[model samples]
Target: MPHIHVRHYPRNFTEEQLRAIDEAVTAAVTSTFATGEDTVSISLEPVTPEDWDSQVLAEIAARRDELIKAPGYWNES
Candidate 1:
């Protein structure tokens, strides 16, 4: 099974956009891991912008090296 979790700021995306995101994420995971789209699971987590640093960025930074796809914005020196 391939599980994908996407975290983003609340109210930034519409329903159609989220659906597109879910489709794209499913395609990516299925292609990358050779898994069926039916077996892939995607979860979208919405967090407030004010809590982004502590809720998302901090966790990603702490495990940066372990991330398969790290955000480019966080890679700037």
Candidate 2:
């Protein structure tokens, strides 16, 4: 039940890059959760800098307690 979602700035990634990411994420998730490769899923979403505060920051703040690892950036505004 480990579904990974990555939100990042907009960019066009080639198929190789996408595949690499999926493989890397899958490996990490499997190692961390001791889960099988078949049970993991990954998705990436593009978030522009303009909407980072209202969208990403808000989400991080809202889910602070549940964050496995907090980011170095961001603060109350």
Candidate 3:
């Protein structure tokens, strides 16, 4: 079982864009782990920029070492 969670700012992505993201992410995960699409799960969360520091950044910072793929933008000092 593979579970993937994607969090991003909800600026102005259309429904098609979000669907595309879901497809691409699922494909990547499936390809990397050699899993069936039916066995993979993906969830997309939209967080506001204002609350990113408290909601997302804080959690990431706490588990930084555990993250296999951390975004470069958030790592910049």
Best by TM-score: 2
What lDDT is reached at residue 63 by model 1?
Answer: 85
Candidate RMSDs in order:
2.2, 1.4, 2.1
* Model 2 / residue 11 / CA error / Å: 0.4
Q: Tell me how far the alpha carbon of residue 31 in candidate 3 is from the true structure, in angstroms, after superposition.
A: 1.1
lDDT of 2 by residue, 1-77 (tens): 88988999999999999999999999999999999999999999999999998999899999888988877886645
Instruction: Estimate, for each residue in 1-77, the C-alpha lDDT of model 1 and write its tens digit.
Output: 87777788876678899789888888888888988989998887889999998889899988878887878788534
For residues 20-48, could you state the per-residue lDDT of candidate 3 as single tens digits? 98789889989999988898887778899
Q: Extract clashing residue pairs from model 3.
A: none
Q: What's model 2's lDDT at 75?
A: 62
lDDT of 2 at 72: 83
What TM-score would candidate 2 get against the native?
0.88
**Candidate 2: misplaced stretches above 4 Å?**
none
C-alpha displacement of 43 in model 2, angstroms? 0.5
